[model samples]
Target: MKNFKPIWLMVCTLALACAPSSKDEQTAENEETSIFRHQPLVTHMYTADPSAHVFEGKIYIYPSHDIETGATSDDMGGHFDMKDYHVFSMDEPGAAVKDHGPVLKLEDIPWASRQLWAPDAAHKEGKYYLYFPAKDQDDIFRIGVAVADNPAGPFKAQPNPIKGSYSMDPAVFQDDDGSNYLYFGGIWGGQLQWFEDGELVAGRKGPTDGIPAPDQAALMPKVAKLTADMLEMAEKPKDALIVDEQGNPILSGDNQRRFFEGAWVHKYNEQYYLSYSTGDTHNIAYAIGDNPYGPFVHKGNVLLPVQGWTNHHSIVEFEGKWYLFYHDTELSGETHLRNIKMAELQYNPDGTIQTINPMK
Candidate 1:
């Protein structure tokens, strides 16, 4: 009996020695969770062009709902046949996201014809406003406003689009002084090239063959101050100039730093940051200026190319941490059908942002 007891005790000791340590178990769990953290924020359906914001201690994402339409791919983005907007909310990053389904649709908008593209949201005086761009009956893109009582909304679209609003990707930036500004525009299919000296050229197809001469001043995005009611442009839209260290307008040929689409503005440490996609270059670049309307000096790329052709993003600080919300084609493996993602964004001591590589 004593010999049998020793054998039993020896087996138990060997089993305990081979068992995983608590630290090892914890590390394994963290690795599994990290894999999820890098994946899409919502996978039930495709969502892209995330315009994330922190509202009332919750993160609200206004994204373009990507649908599988058989439209052929083109430089004009004809394949991106989105027709509605959906609002997504999460208590925190990497947490469960709730899809508040179809906040605004094309059929409900009186002036919108088709193609509900990238959208952004803002809160003022206890009301939430959704600002989006859609093509009007004339096939020219126009920005529109919709209102809601809640962040996650079934918003009511205004009967008419904002007066003097053109182009796509409407990003509303509220400055520290309580002034709200609209930053918008995109070239090529977005049709910013069609406007010469602020007037549309009749019957002009593919202006400048899609770009100005290499030495020519690069096209600029438009910025306008919003009215007090947040429904109309307070004045004429002005060029939000992005320039080199020498203060020269970035040349049209410098695709790497040129403004193509997706304008986002956020302030940090009293400096205004203007970030946008360098469209065909597939990088998210930024510029810094002292004021909201800027002759902003170009910084560097905020994000490198992801798995898709288009990369749109928004930056917001939540719970004392900053995050970049962007999109990729990880889920559908198609450019037009993309999925939204979020990652932590960091800044240097000099206020320059650390370049984020999505492939990492």
Candidate 2:
């Protein structure tokens, strides 16, 4: 509605100036050409659900690879492509693509019998860890974790499942205060975890694990502070809730009408912005909060329904501008065809998000 048609033309010129434009100098003698050229920074063909991280001096994107012997379409269930995992890197955040390795795959996991999707990575001590939601041939999806000394990994999965439940889209976080927490799940509920000892055990499926207890993933988003050991819950490790039942020190997001799933945390100055994909990923949404783990106040439409479907995003601020890293179905189709995209996020001076258009 902003008449961004010119934006597309500019993007084409910016994206294709190196190509043979077939323009004649004689016919355009008086014309000034603003031909901007941009190469494709991402090229993990047949992939999506990209989880991006900036490690050391390079930027890495880990996307779920959906390639079958010969499938022609994609749907909500990702019927067209089973899952294979791959990682790609770039010199700068939005420029210079690099290849670290195909670093990981489902076959790398001994206990995993099928699809591997939505991989999240983090750096700890002197090592790196990758957590993902994967499904076996039986179609039952479970959460798994692997490690490597390098950001790019020959990531090897341990012998068991982290959380053997039907879930997808996980994000691992080591908050600003040096707190380590993990968030995952799509429509079901985004659950939280605290890294204490050596094992990443199931904690209170707080607010986001929408359903009451016994449900594998909680119905809403939760914040569980990891115990000193950095693996399980604190002293009384049994109750996953970091606080009390009336939503004490921290509040959370829940219900189908708001904060559906796929959450991320970005700390800007004194406040932290918690962005999540809402309305079933087909149409995404965002919410903001003063605290990292909060009853985030809705910032209003960060993204509306994108081309059919989209979800599992990463957002970070570099320099002084905000850039959103998300995947949509425009390039491939459906959930996993998550072409890693970079877009400018408009924000009000008061720290709230402005309206934005769908990604191309």
Candidate 3:
């Protein structure tokens, strides 16, 4: 669900969190706010290309489900078996329905084989890994791995997948130093990996034109700087735009194309909020960073970009509030019949991140 189309224009110069100096006024450190305003209370009528996790307190939605006319559930690993992949839980926001389905597919998998796209799942240490983007047997699409203990499972797959070439969206993060990171590519630019028990020590590759792209779209991004067992990289190979989150400077040349790519990081209070998905994912843009590898900063406009392509998004807090996991496409207006959604996210008391506009 890399909707891609978003690209509007943002500029927020920082301040109580910027951009709301007048949208109605609130940030004088909290004009006595009450809660839940700008967006996302629920909208996922079918859920598409989404990813979320908050366990225990609730909030679970894995997207890119298939079959039932929409095709692709030959067991969740397509090539035409039909398609299959599911995992749903909705403590709220778009409260998914329809039995929450599959849990995992591709006929339950056997390995080194077939086609699967998108399919992202994460939950470290205790179990669960389902990161999609498959196609071995020589077809080459890259990225695949599976294992489960719960989170609606039945998963298995392995025998292959978890390298690179033409990977699709596969996100699995677990950082803060504890390690474990894997992000994929799409629309045109995306890639990143780091695993251990699941293998694949390290990775990164992207740009047939996508990811903070724009050079007419050949959006090249190539990063490599690992050794601490991230498997590979670092004999000298760097180019994920040099580093923009705090190492500073990065934007590069033609303004570095545009279509920013999807990256998420959240912490607040002491800083570490880096959210992504920009213009070209059907219109959605965000930037912030005390570090997620970004000179981030772009916080001024297009916070959700509705009216057309929406996108793959994530951010969480639930029950305690704070959310942004996304996916849109009019929920029906076509656009691949998109779904998966969430909203409620309004911060400012000096934490930054607050801007919405797509309700037209």
Tens-place lDDT digits, model 3, residues 1-360: 333222221112133356456544635333332122333223433455567777655677677652224434231223122256777776675554434566666655545354455566766556766777655564445656677777677677666554443445655555567555554443332322222222333332323222332223223223223224333322333223323334443332323223345544556665655455553534444545554344455454336465444366777777777877666554344444555556667887866667765453
The TM-score values for the models, in the order shown, are 0.89, 0.69, 0.29
Best by TM-score: 1
Number of colliding residue pairs in model 3: 44
Query: What tens digits encode model 2's per-residue C-alpha lDDT throughout 140-240?
Result: 45567777888888787666665323355667667777777666555432222322232323653333233434323233543444444333323221222
Candidate 2 local accuracy as lDDT?
A: 0.55
| Candidate 2 residue 122 C-alpha distance from true site, Å | 0.7
TM-score of 1: 0.89
Q: What is the C-alpha RMSD of each candidate to the true structure, in Å?
A: 9.8, 8.3, 19.7
Ten residues in a row with the worst lDDT in model 3? 4-13
lDDT of each: 0.88, 0.55, 0.50
Clashes of each: 0, 23, 44
Q: How far is candidate 1 from the true structure (C-alpha RMSD, Å)?
A: 9.8
User: By TM-score, how accurate is candidate 2?
Assistant: 0.69
